[model samples]
Target: MSGESAPRATVGSESLERAFGGTAACNACGARVAEYRVVALFLHETAAIRAYCARCYPAAADGDYHAGGDGLRLDYAAFAARFGAPGPPPPPTTPVDRMLAALVADPALRLLAPGSEAVARRRRRVPYPVRVGFALDGATSEARMSVAPDGRMTDLAGDPAACDRVRALLAGI
Candidate 1:
């Protein structure tokens, strides 16, 4: 197995059909495939996620599986450049982000919050609003964190304890 490679399924083959579909394409080569592992450099609201094929992906790279997108081929080197050694992950969510996700999903939360604009602002203020929403239900809220375009937590509600806790959590990161 050291020198051998995993068999490549044809684009329309059944094996490929079963495994692939939503996988992201390689950032550099644009190979839409499911064979590569995903290498994500955790970013704030989003992840600099990339996929690498067994051949194109780094054999020694570590991270999650690569799901393809568009028609991009996996590019292991480029992915490594971005993710490298990701800084500490985001903090756990406040009670607010969690509630909003559930509400967004059920449509009831959006209806009940003060107003659409207010709710939106709260979402922006919350940690990892896009990913860790309802998933981190009771995750210490104190550790909940988010990343903004400027690469820092833009807002944390500033309720003393919450602000201090997150500030400490994101200190050098």
Candidate 2:
């Protein structure tokens, strides 16, 4: 989850834009904003996008990166202590693998940082059922996917919006 474009998105209350914008809730502040200063979308975590307003912009993650004039400093040792190894090992090869990878690679799905390593292990049976079953297991969430006989309907165990996003991702593949 590192690229852009979520198919359906919006900016702020100013206007109703299209193509991967964001929601109304401010990540820093619970109130709905008049205009979204920033939107953050994470894969496999929340279904909706995160909206940040101008009032809370300085308190968001971008602010942490911007380094405000508070004289706060995180040296190398502190950084190392704060963050250990990045994540679990990458998922092994499987029939349903790389779908998420494709989503991550797509420049159109500017998803936030990926939190865990997930594998798409195929649930197999004889004759290759049209209703394919697979699971994507990550460090935090485990998502299950199944296709209908016609290959139209899909069932995802996690967030509905996330399920829709995954369905869209799989559709593109």
Q: Which residue pairs come into collision in candidate 2? A: 3-110, 4-108, 4-109, 4-110, 5-108, 9-20, 9-21, 10-21, 10-22
The Cα RMSD in angstroms, rounded to one decimal, for candidate 2 relative to the true structure is 15.9
Candidate 2: tens digits of C-alpha lDDT, residues 16-133: 2211234355544455545555432222321122345567554333311111111112222232233321122223322322343444433333222221112111223322222111
Top of the candidates by TM-score = 1
Provide the overall lDDT of each model, using Cα atoms, as 2-decimal numbers.
0.33, 0.33
Quote the lDDT for 51 in model 1.
48
Overall local distance difference test of candidate 1: 0.33
Give the per-residue lDDT of model 1 (tens digit) for 20-118.
355646533557666555433222222233445556555313222222232222223332343232333344434433332223332111011211112
lDDT of 2: 0.33
| TM-score for each of the candidates | 0.24, 0.23
